[model samples]
Target: MSGTERGGGSTVDAVRAWRGLAETSVLLDGFHALKHALRFGARVPVALTSDKAAVLALAEDLAPDVTRPLETLLAETDEATLRALVPRLHPTSVAALAVRPSRAAQLETLARLPRTAPVVVLDEPRNLGNAGAVIRLAAGFGATGVVTTGTLDPWHPTVVRGGAGLHFATAVERVDADRLPPGPLFALDAEGEDIRALKLPDDAVLAFGSERSGLSEGLRARAEHLVSLPMRPQVSSYNLATSVGMTLFHWASTSGRPPGTGA
Candidate 1:
């Protein structure tokens, strides 16, 4: 089960049903969530849990002024009504609640952003867990945004589950390659040029290959360059999410920018 962080402490006064994403978010990565929530300077308005002790502890950790007690936590139970509440809280602090369709389309809307910005595009990867993990890592690495082409769905349950609370913190767009902003595109490939040797631009699209098949022909043709991770002969390549994270980290390190500072 998972849940989102809903804004408005006043909303907490009334015991409205909370969606699962928020409930599960509390458990996704305790240390990471706590750190991110604090890093972004978020006030945890409610800590709804079945157990009183856990609520108290979370309140103490997050800040006593904002914590709201609830009768139950949504993640532990499979209640349909509670689950349905997710879409209703669209654009709320709970990042996973409902993604605006306009926001979804903007991922490929080139006019809104610069061509050289650090963008991540995943193509038909098919695995929500990988996508969600990539979202978290993308935020950690200071990506300007995330865009998915083909059939990859960012709102899929598994991906949302993997993202924890990270989905709320960053801009994620889903679109096709044609919709992507104009720029120097680089696809991650095992046989491509060494990433370490390439003169990576401060702003460019880093297209991660599909988890199973690597880059699609459409993406391959669209990319201006191909990059590869360094590895011993035994290991063919890195995990889809791992490769994206490592590449983003390398870009950040070489650019002399701190992690998570989006250009």
Candidate 2:
């Protein structure tokens, strides 16, 4: 019998649950993805692995803290079974499903005032990978959220795959340009003021134009400050993800770090 139909509703129970929830749930693709998601408090309903010993070894080597919980959660199944469940198997050979946060909860978090970190705004972003990379950066830098003002779903499966399941670490959502959170809007533009001269505020909305065509007229009009990164004379613009990394690093250097963190 298939692992999905064996035992006293053992792994089969969990596997069946995963199958039922897969369409609506968030897929945690690999070992690292599952690890990060669990660490960040994602509500994972089920996890399956081909080799529990190997995954546990990985846990022991990299994340000793989660080993006990993983022991209770990981359901051991054969390779064929795992391959049948997940479309493309991860190199580490592990997969899981977690609950996606509600739009209402994300909206509420984004709208809350007295914000400590900046909210990253991707104005009409076209690339899914770029948006995912931006979300990963935002999470690493402790940005309040990563908001996209465009048709691209920031939480698409491809983007989620690119993000390595770090979406649970921060707020990510899509909304119209006019509905962005309350903060000082600092939009990045080629003709704007030099970024080095100013100290970005804690509650700033650090906005970046899309990969192509730059910001829309409506978004540009909403910008309180137009900031520019230092680029050579001939260069037109940096890659969208690279630009966000540079800008976020600047924010971390100025406000996110402790007074003597590196020293």
Candidate 3:
């Protein structure tokens, strides 16, 4: 597992010969790539590098297990060769699947989940950190998955780091508003009905909008119910993630729903 460098296409061949989805994904060239891989806890199956010294040095320091020495990993390479190398590269046991979805559609995906102990969706959310942190939080709260609309790539290096390893375990689907699965949709809005007083349905799709605009007109219209979290009159509004977390917690406490149970 230490600084052992195997030479030639054999190392590349060894990586390419791997059968299952890479238990780990390793990125070459930049720090962001490395950061994302590390954040997801993906095993560094092999290191592809132009700088042999640098590659060996990196292997010595960071990834002791994966050290496949290859020339094709250098900066200048063709797609055919890269494609050939990809299968061989092993991803970690828990792979971080990434997606970049549009604003409206991501919202729609959120609008589709079952209300009973389901996933969280953020529609047309602009903040990258909020989107990433929310995905991470959703995983932490034991939500089934996360849907994002109008935001950065959840698997983007920065977002992955923000997720703090939560992204790998969660199903993040990027979809359009029109494609949302049919269900009881609810929106969290200040003007909505009191969450405590309202009778929450057995199954629901809870959708939250951005901080400034709140839920969109179309989203507001689609919701079967509009729910609001009780708060101090002096407080203006909760952060998007905070609001969603509150609603999730509220449902968890009130619904008597078991974890991973669906509507």
lDDT of 1 by residue, 1-263 (tens): 11134433333331343343355322222323433443343344333222335534555576554343222221222223323443332211122123223563445443355533477889778788899899888777767667888887775656655775565566676776687755679988877899999767766888987888888888888788989899989987788888988888888878876876545
Error of 2 at 162 (Å): 1.5
Give the TM-scores of the predictions, in the order they appear: 0.70, 0.93, 0.58
Error of 1 at 137 (Å): 0.4
Ranking by TM-score: 2, 1, 3
lDDT (10s digit) by residue, model 2, range 58-169:
9999998778768878888889989999969998999988888999999888887787778899999999989888988888888888899879999888788888888998
Which of the numbered candidates is closest to the native, going by highest TM-score? 2
RMSD of each: 6.9, 4.3, 9.5
lDDT of 1: 0.60
Clashes of 2: 0
Better of 1 and 3 by lDDT: 1
Error of 3 at 58 (Å): 19
Cα lDDT tens digits, model 3, 1-263, are: 11122223453453452323233331222433443344434333344332345544555566554333222222322334545544332232111222223445534544544444555667777777787778767766556567665654555545555565566445566556555544567888888899988654545567888878887788788877888898899998889888877877777767676644544
Q: Which ten residues in a row have the lowest lDDT in candidate 3?
A: 89-98
